[model samples]
Target: MLSDLLMLAAAVVAGRDIVVKAVRARTVGIDLLVSVAAVGAVIIGNFWEAAAVTFLFAIGHALEAATLNKTRSALAELVAVAPDTAVVLRDGEQREVPAAQVRMGEIVLVKNGAKVPVDGQVVAGTGAVDEASITGESIPVEKAKSDAVFAGTVSRGGFLQVLATGIGADTTLARIIHRVEEAQDAKARTQTFIDRFSKWYTPGVMMLALVAGLLSGDVVLALTLLVIGCPGALVISIPVAIVAGIGRAARDGILIKGGEYLETSAKISAVAVDKTGTLTEGRPELTDVVVLDPALDRTELLRWAAAAEAGSEHPLARPILDTARAEGVAPVGVPGTVTPVPGKGIVSDVGGRRVLIGNPALLEQYGVTDDAGAAEAARGLAAEGKTPMIVAVGRTVAGVVAVADRVRADAARMVARLHSAGVEKVVMLTGDTRLVAESIGRAAGIDEVRASLLPEDKLDAVSELQREGHTVAMVGDGVNDAPALATADIGVAMGAAGSAVAVETADIALMGDNLLKLPESISLAKRTVNVMRQNISIALITVVLLLGGVFAGGVTMSAGMLVHEASVLVVIVNAMRLMRRTQGSTATPRSRWSPARPREAVDA
Candidate 1:
């Protein structure tokens, strides 16, 4: 009798909060059902059954909370890495203050091995920063003056004075954390249906338990029915899967916006990529120098062109100046009196004579005829996918110099992997001319080319693909592509570690600059969605079998609770499989291509 009374006290200790919460909320939940079953067992003189039910429920709730937090550990780690304090240079004296108190435009000092406290420009000194926290790239990137640095990245080797541009919640790390939390909390379509089903299913089960007790006069059987019909596994199935899948992705530096975006990413049939920065290196290099006038020679032609461009800031000017300096024919100083002929080129005084370097349009604008076959040479270079500039010396054509942006080493391989991962088409979109865009498309193994696009024109291309019943993913890195990126089914931002806007606004943000991560993100999404379906099925089947066993007279109150707890554990363990690193996640196969033969011959 004494031992039975102690067991009764244990049941009250475990179940008081649940009973009080049910009373205050004025709603029917699984907690109330379990509490009522325990009380009914006690009133029927089943002291052992009451103690067992309440003790098991308490232990399961504790375990569930602990394991659920583990699934969200990735986001937790991000929060822990956020810097709490910063060393600021206030009034020329170094002062330590809370990271949130650091004002914009104030200089903050980052010592070796210290965490970067704000997103800002490195104004003085240099360092190597391990940016794994931001970009998910493990290698330390060299940061010099004028380079951008993000908060939460560590300074590995040198000291730096950074001008704070973003602090506290405005930093990229903060935005990433907010996006991840929102994603984990957002419900999928299936989850919404399950929620509604659970609400009515619990109350209906309680009514059935009362009817069974009335018809058969078996109090124990009615209480056993309540124990097995708790809907514990069904309630937790989808949330655990979503949290695990999204948290694992965050660890790998892939930010999936939410459950809906994850669902959409699994159906991506086409990917439209910007050519300049996505397929080819955004930087141009000097490639060819053809002398139209044999009398002037290569050195004289380059010298005149370099002098004309020395005072200009055009995108193509750096390559010409760099090549001239390397060849020992660069201009001694900046040119005198430079005039930019809009959309054509520049005119400058080199050695007291007018030197013009641009397209044929510039020569026509200035009434300088190309008598040395310079126009013909420029046409040949342009046909080869190079930007050619005509160099003229006082109305006489000197030579044609050309530059081209080199394709990234992994671009063609990225296309092949996309095809292997089930993408039906890879299209190249760019503002470049048709010749240049097609040339890049062929080299990158793309199926279609939409060139000479304005910023808005890219959006129209994405819309056109959708009209054709394709789910399009647009990948880009610049502000100009923001419209198209926002309009696509999935907006993927590449090399987004440096841009806070990309981290916040992109549907999917790749922390590193790897091209292969694009296909990998889609593949992971498909796998995660598949796992979610499997888990939901496991939960519902477990619930059905338990209910059948109870009515068939094989399941008792204690046995039903055991099976229900076991099913919940099963669902959670299944979702944990997403945390493992996939085999061949990093390897990219090379696509075969030859410069001597056309792309058709090699690809075919």
Candidate 2:
């Protein structure tokens, strides 16, 4: 009687929630199946079996909950770092207030070891900020006036006065937390299919259990089938993998929009990148100034170029103006009217003379014949990967000035890593001349180049790749790339931490300027998809094995429950693998071009 009472107490304590859910919810689920199985076992006087099954299941439930929380540890850490208070300057005095209470445009003071309380630009002082909370980079970045600082990052040393531009929920950290939570809850395509499968699968299991008992008159067999037929592992298979994968990426500052994006990213075959910012520094510097007319010296040619460019806001204008300023021939008189020719260059009216600086097309548009071989000189500079701008003075060919943007150091490594991650083509799409684009492409190991393209042409280039049966990802940081980004299978925004638009709009947002995160995101998605598949397979196989064993011989209700719980734990453990970073995730891949093997080695 004592033993029976102990068994009854264990069933009540461990199985109460299951019974309540089954009765109160009016829905059939794993809870219902487990409740019915335990009740049946008790009615048949198998008290120990009832006690053992519920107890083991309760233990497994505790373990699963703990392990699942471990998978979300990265996101939890992010949430914990959110700033709670701010030190703001009010009426020339520092005041402490709730972080959210600080008004926009308020001056906030950040001291050493304090969390930056708002996203803003540094207006005074200097410091090294540990932006690891925001960018996932461990090294502290030096901050000064005009440099942007994000909330939730710590000031490693020194002090700073920040002008609050984004506060409270408007900050980057808040956006990241919200995105991660939504991504975790959003279902993948495979998860959706599994959900529909489980809708009928649970009831089918109960029906099979009932029929088996009725045909064979085996009460023990029916109870055992229900205990093992919960579908616990199968239902959680995809979600666990997605949560872990996304959380892992968030830790590394790579934000995937959702599970659907994660799936599509795994299949990316082509990556279309904008050449200006994505591949090169986007800061053009005047490299050469060749005088075509005998009357003009090198300084005279620069005077005309800088005179027109000084009134323009083009990226190429800065380098020319800077070079001229350093040479003591900066344009003293601003142009009366500066007209920008899209995809060509600039036409400016300076001191009552028409000063045209552009490509061959601009010269032709004005019917200016290049008798001085200005076009040929421009071509020679362009072939060397420089953007050559021909200067014309009142229809007279003046000279050719070339500007070049330095290529990023990690660009070639990024391309090699993309190949290692299974991307077949890395294409450069730009409005720069074909020769300049080709030069950049060869240096960066890009497979294709689409140059001299207008913004619309970029959209068409992405479409062309898609039409060729390629799953494309367009990477860029400008408005011109917007159409192509929207049309591609995935839109990746580089250095997205500074732009709210990029953070919200991109399919994959790399918070840091680091080029390596692109391929890391792809490889991670592939690993996550593989883990989901493996989990589903494990769940199905365990169910099949348990079913066969229950009928073939010695599988009791207790044994079936034990095996069912074990399989669920295994799936969770497999998903936990994503939370750990691998060495290859950041390592640069070796050059893809290898020497041909000997004939005997090829045969072998």
Candidate 3:
């Protein structure tokens, strides 16, 4: 009698919430199945069976909650880094205030080793910031005037007076946190199907158990069926994997939009990149100035080029102006009038004479003969990987000036890593001439180069790759690349912290400018998808084996519960592995972005 009372007490205590939920919902669930089975066991005078079933189910629920929280640790860590207070300059005095209370455009002071309280631009002083919280890189990056600094990052050294651009929820850290939360909650395709299957599968199990109990007069068998019919592991299999995978990527500064995007990213077979900023420095420098006229020298040619480009806003104009000023031949003033010719170059009126600086096509358009072989000279420079421009004074060809943008040190390694990550093709699309594009392409180990493309042409290139049955990921950081980015299967934005559009719109936004993160993101996606598949298999196999054992006559109510709970725990444990950093995820600062040594120099 005492043992039966103890069993009754345990069943009521452990199964109270489960019974209450089933009553309130007026629907069947795993909770209802477990509750009814425990009640039936007690009615049948199986006191020990009743107590053990309820106790094990309760214990399993507790363990699942605890382990699932561990999988979301990445997001928890990010939330912990948000700054609570800030030091701001108010009326020429330093004051401490809540980070969110600081007004926009306020000048916030960050001391050495202090956490930056707002996203802003550094206006004074210098420092080394440990941006691991933002970029997931452990190295300290040096900061200076005009450099962007994010909130929740620590200043490793020096002090800074920053102009606040973003505060409170407007900051990048806040956006990342919000994005991660949404991604974790979003369901994957496989998960949706599993959910639909469970909706009917649970009721079907109860009906099958009832029919078997009535047909064979076996009450013990019916009780065991309800205990094992919970579908605990199978229902949660895909969701746990997705949460862990998305959370893991967040810690590494890669934000996947949602589970749908993760599945797509895993299938990325082709990568398309923009040439200007994706592969090169994007900053061009004047390298050579050849004077075609025997009467003029290098200085004279540079001076004319600078004079025409004086009033221009073109990217190539800055290098010419900077070089001319350094050589003490800066243009006295802006050109009187500057007219730009699309796809060609600029036509400017400098000193009451028409100065044309453009490609050979531009000279031909204006009916200017290429005297002194200026066009041929420009072609020679282009062959050497320089962007050459022909300079003309009225109808006579003046000279050729060449500018070159240096290829990023990690360009080749990034391409090679993409291939290793299973990308079959790495293509570069640019508006540069074929010669200039091929030069950088060879240096970067690019498999395909599509040159002299307009913005629409870039979109067409992505479409062409898609028609060839390739899943393409477009990597770029320019306004012109927006259409192509949207057209590709996955849009990757590098150095996205500063671009609000990229952060919000990209399929995967890599917070840092590290070239290696591109391949890392792809590899991570693949691993995550594999985990999802493995988890599904484990859940399904466990269910099938437990059902077979119960009918085959050795499995009891308590034993089946134990095995079901164990399978759920195993799935959660497998997902947690994604939280750990994989091999090659990081490298020493010296090996990152540093120029490669020449072949001859290395041999020596």
Candidate 4:
């Protein structure tokens, strides 16, 4: 084995003409130092010693590659978004072009089977597009003229003529991919440590080798010490561990926004959460309806309101249309023009009468708001944990229907489970109003609530928590949530049921929509960190102990190699434990009391 290794080193030197030049350049790298050690082994007639050094290096390198492949593969999910081609009307001739070259403002002809080329409005045709991959809604949404369409979404049945508004990097899908790349490139604590240590540690070992050679007048002894002090395992261990943790996280459908998450998740003390969307299912449902006009039954009023809202875009419109369709009511014919009031609802003429389906603010603006006598009932429903959207026809209150997205069944149990796993803070962050935020927070066992925030507000909320010297994790799933996700110490994207931008921007992604899985991911990361630290510590300790033994004058090169290999095996086995995550896990909670303000989870 020693003779074979010497031959291999000779072959490498003869094959690489640049090796001599690099050595002459005075840059004594790890490879160069190892090469000198191999030469020294040959001088001492211990050819096996030279071979053992290179063999250990090769094994360390192979293990590093395997671990990186296993851990850094989360970004492969973007391959599914590859758009083949687009049909565009160029100079009145509809021709196909690769999606990469498709430009903004081009009239692209999207057929039933084609994915939308870019983010834009449907200026020419109507079709329902499956935005679930980007929005996690699961249902195909209808899009027509003036309705927004996203790049990479599939057209379900009808052809669409999309006037491309956002193309290339500006498209939503591209934005997500770009963010993911950025996060992956961002440095983590473990990587930073290796970089800082390598700068000074490498040169110090070289100087030590020179001193030893001068004192002993034996180049072989100094070379052996240099080989033993390569720090190869330490350099590779941290990154291998990080990528492994991240890869396992991706397999579970969690996108970690960046390296920062690993650090923050380990340190968070107290947790606060937003109620709606975070603790409860974001989809609103029609729970109850009150009919003010005896002439109009619950079904008729619902049908009219849904028809009016159909032309208007809002999440609450789904429950109305779903209920109306299930009850067999014919929809009011859509009008040519419809106007929406921000706080109120939408107003459109339906069935030849002026229809006003909105809250009091909309009616009051027109000086025709009505009490409708359902306020008291709505308030009672609110206390019982239901959200109510008011509906009125003209100035007279027609009805107030209670709509609520139920709290997730797994929430309370998951919170308790994480607590048991030693996560001191269990938080929920949501964009719902105070009433809605509190209702879900109490039921889900969240420590606190931060409510009524728009996109910027949500980012600020996370920033404030950070300024107070707390590590924070922000989880969300919309375009509006992107900033907060970027700003948080750790941004966990709800991947499987989350928006593309959300997943791409997040430092970590959750493949499972159940919020319970977040604790699971955090646990996995912490374990990986622990294993990597262990691997590094063991390797360094073994090198020190063995090298000291060799200088004490009784150690053989073959025996030293055996000790190094043993340490290497221990490191690899320790890293493997990260594959199994606890049912729920998170950071240790500290005794340092941060203020417990009952702030609502604000929207980003």
Candidate 5:
């Protein structure tokens, strides 16, 4: 920059009638304009104005570049964690190999502190892994054999042989990188304003310079006019603000992928929250137990259902197994045959009797929906967002287990804050039944509820809402929530234990588990956006004032440039003030959301 400015100074001293430098240096921003204007100044010997104009533009560019450079460090950090090779296990022997060369079913050994090189299943070892770089959790997670691991995660302990099912760009880390890059490139409202401003400003300045040249017999005046209207500083105002906003958010536990989400978040008319993980603790507890028959005790039913569920992998299964474990009720181990019915439930053998553990679909198969009591229990469970697991012996239902996701302590107040920030609607969406979704919705002060949606169907809901011309923000925390997150106008991911693929895929992510940050983030964005519009107005007004005085004296080319530079500084300073305001009133969190209210609500 210094070199460019000095070159402009040298070019100016050469005077208007004698130009000799190549086109390369002449195309280098304000320096080129300053160089031509400076030559005019020297030919006319207005040296002070020529040098000052060049100096102001150089400084503006420097500051603009500085503000936008924050993203480079994060990108660099990501690259540094990216592994270059893998330890491929072939024929029971581990061999050093390139990550890309490792095909499907290849086993790779990853040790502590080493990044997992591919998306694969852990075939051996029990160790804790830190996926926080991806999940934004501060705690390292325990991983065991048969557990899935993604690339770029740090194995905190133990040595593992991971069987590679996904490699290269197909890895979870790769997808995250791709999503982050895409979000970065996505245009923000503020960027559009700057683009539009520059597109017209440049041409308008050129025309103004021509008019000045026609009116003034001196060509130097026109050249000076061109120097006065350089759009360099004005072009960078909002981008610098956005870059800084993203950087500050990263520090506070939010990863804003692009300026668009940041800008849109400031204007969200309605916030559609995912109840299970967005506004709640998401970890459901085994809270209710009902026996279907007086002959079967509750403990026996829970034990058998847990035994059957031991082989099943589902979030709902954990509470049943965990409750059985806690009650000292040993699960029945006599499992000769077990078959998991897809999307319905699990059927297995217990002490020579077939036990079915699942929802209503499973009950209907056995002609066991015979009593009003059983149907009512299922209905009651659905009402509270609890999935009822029925444990049956022969064709008779023996026991029922009910579970509910715990809600965050701060969710209700957060909704109120969002409402205060201009959110017109607060809706809750969940795959849990209508009763559960509605129950959780009312607890969190949500105005509406959409429940029992499949993952793809959730995307359709977002599309339907967008078609209504509403700017929507979807907050979610599950891997199942990814498609909807991608489909929403703005996707906000809960960063903690939420899936890495989901977090990476989201436009914005809450880094810590504190969900109240959602409202805070929206508020901060609103203030910054408003400040940006104000700055542009101020900048354009300054341009108008400077142009009006261009020929009438007191507004030399250098003087106009100085005022423009000052205006740029003023805007940058104003935008930086947002970083100091609390995103809400506290720190940050990225954990899941779950409803924790009682089975029924109390009128306040």
Candidate 6:
């Protein structure tokens, strides 16, 4: 009698809130059904069974809460990294204040081992900042004047005075947190169907239990059915997987938009990458100086080219001027009377002699004969992916000065890794000439090349890929690629730490500039989707077997509750596997070219 009273008290303690919540909400939940089943067991004098059912459920709830929080721990870690205090220069005095209180344009001081309190530009001093929180890069980046620094990064050494550009909730960390929460909560199409099924499955199970008990006159069997038919695993299977998958990606500095985007990312087959800033270094550099005039040496050729470009504002001018200065061949001052011809090059008067630096068209425009085979030399440079400029002094061609963008050391490795990751085609799209684009493509191991494309033409290329039944992912960094990015199946933005638009709008935003993350992201998405499928199968098979066991008569109430809780724990633990780092998650492939050979050789 004492055991029965104690067990009844235990059931009431475990079930009161559930009963009250159901009453207040005027709805029937699985918890209410379980509570009813426990109470019925207690009334039938099955004291141990009643106590075991409610106790197991209470234990399961506690475990679920703890483990679910662990699945979401990655985002919690991000929030914890947010700066709390800041040292700001107010009225030329350093003052400590809350990070959120620091006003924009105010100078913030960052000392050694201090966290950067705001996203801003470095105005003075130097430091090595560990930006792992923002970019997931383990190495510390060297920070100096005019360099952009983000909040939550640590200054490993030295000091800095930064002007606050973003503060409080406007910071990137806050935005990342917000995006992660929204992504975790978003539902996929399969999840939506399962949710709908669970809603009706609970009440339907209750009705089946009621009819079975009345017709068969077996009250204990009906109670056991209620304990096992909780839909615990089915309801939480997808959500836990989604939370763990997205959170793990965020920790690695890969931001997937949401569940829907994650689903689409798994289906990506083709990838289109921009040449400049994506596959190669965006900055052009002086590579070759061909002397057509036997009288002038390489240095003299560079000097004449730099003199002609000294007064021009073209994108290719800085490389010439910088190289000239490095080689001690820079002109004394800027050139005189510079005339820039669109689609050609610049013409200027240098040292009282007319200097022309451009393509063959510019030479023809000025009626300068291709004396000394300057045009053929320019074609040779162009074929090797170099932007060739003819240097002419008076009517005689001096030399052909060539400049080319340096291809990234990791470009070829990135292509190979993408293919290894199951990508069907890796295409290079660029506004550069056909020869230049093809040269880069060959070096990078790209499968196809779409050259000399305008911004709109890039979008057309992506659409054409889609029309061919290939799901395309476009990776780019500039505003011109934004249209193609939006039109592709998956729009990937790299080096996205400073770009607010890319951070918010890209399907997958890789915070660091590393190209390896591209293949890693796709691999992760594929693995995550596989986990989701496995979890769903586990849930459905568990439910089917439990229903079968209850009808065939050997599963008791205590045994049913234990199995139900075990299934839930299994699903949670399966999802947590995604949180751990795998070999493919962090692989940085080696360059295909030998270390002894210069990267410029490939560009040539």
Top candidate by lDDT: 2
Q: List the candidates' TM-scores in order.
A: 0.87, 0.95, 0.95, 0.70, 0.74, 0.91
lDDT of each: 0.82, 0.86, 0.86, 0.64, 0.68, 0.84
Model 6 local distance difference test score: 0.84
Which residue pairs in candidate 6 have backbone atoms (N, alpha carbon, C) closer than 3 angstroms, thus clashing?
none
| Candidate 4 Cα lDDT to native | 0.64
Candidate 4 lDDT score at position 474: 72
Instruction: Write one digit per residue (lDDT tens) for candidate 1, span 274-363.
Output: 887678777778888888887877788888888888998776788889999999998888888898875567789987899888878788
304 Cα displacement, candidate 1 (Å): 4.4
* Residue pairs of candidate 1 with colliding backbone atoms: none
lDDT of 4 by residue, 1-604 (tens): 7666666675354323323543765555666666666666766766666666656655554565575554545455554664768889999999999887888899998889788878788898888787644442345777778877778778988988999888777776666555555655666777797778876887888888889989999777787777767666666666656655655554444556566576566665544444545566666677877787666888877876776766765666667778887888747556545777654556776655656665445656676645555556556656656666566665566776667777777779767766764567665565555666677778888777766567788888878888877677776654567677778777666533324544454556653455666667666656766777787898788878877986987666546655665666566556655545444432221111111111111111
- Once superposed on the true structure, which residue ranges of model 6 sit more than 4 Å away at CA? 21-29, 39-47, 294-300, 328-357, 361-371, 392-396, 587-604
- Sort the candidates on lDDT, descending order: 2, 3, 6, 1, 5, 4
Q: How big is the positional error of residue 483 in model 5, measured in Å on the Cα after superposition? A: 3.7
Q: List where candidate 4 sits over 4 angstroms from the true fold.
A: 1-27, 44-187, 216-220, 257-261, 268-278, 292-311, 335-339, 346-372, 417-431, 496-500, 580-604
Candidate 6 residue-wise lDDT, 1-604, digit = tens: 8877898898778767656765675556668777878888988989788888888888888898899999999999998889899999888788999998999999999999999989999999998888888877777888889988899989999999999998887777777888889989999777888878877888998998899999999999888888888888888888888889898899888999888888788888999999888897777888988898889899888888888888987777878899999989888888778987765667899988999887777888899998688777767877887777888899898988888887898889899999988899999988776777888899999999998788899999999999999989999874879899989989998888866877888989988877888888888888888888988888779878987988888788988889988988999999999999878665332121111111111112
Model 5 lDDT on a 0 to 1 scale:
0.68
lDDT of 3: 0.86
Put the candidates in TM-score order, highest first: 3, 2, 6, 1, 5, 4
**Residue 174 in model 1: lDDT:** 88
Assess candidate 4 and give its TM-score to the true structure: 0.70
Tens digits of lDDT, candidate 2, 227-332:
8888999988899999999999998888899899999999999999988767876666789999999999999999999999989876678888999999999988
Residue 598 error, candidate 4, Å: 22
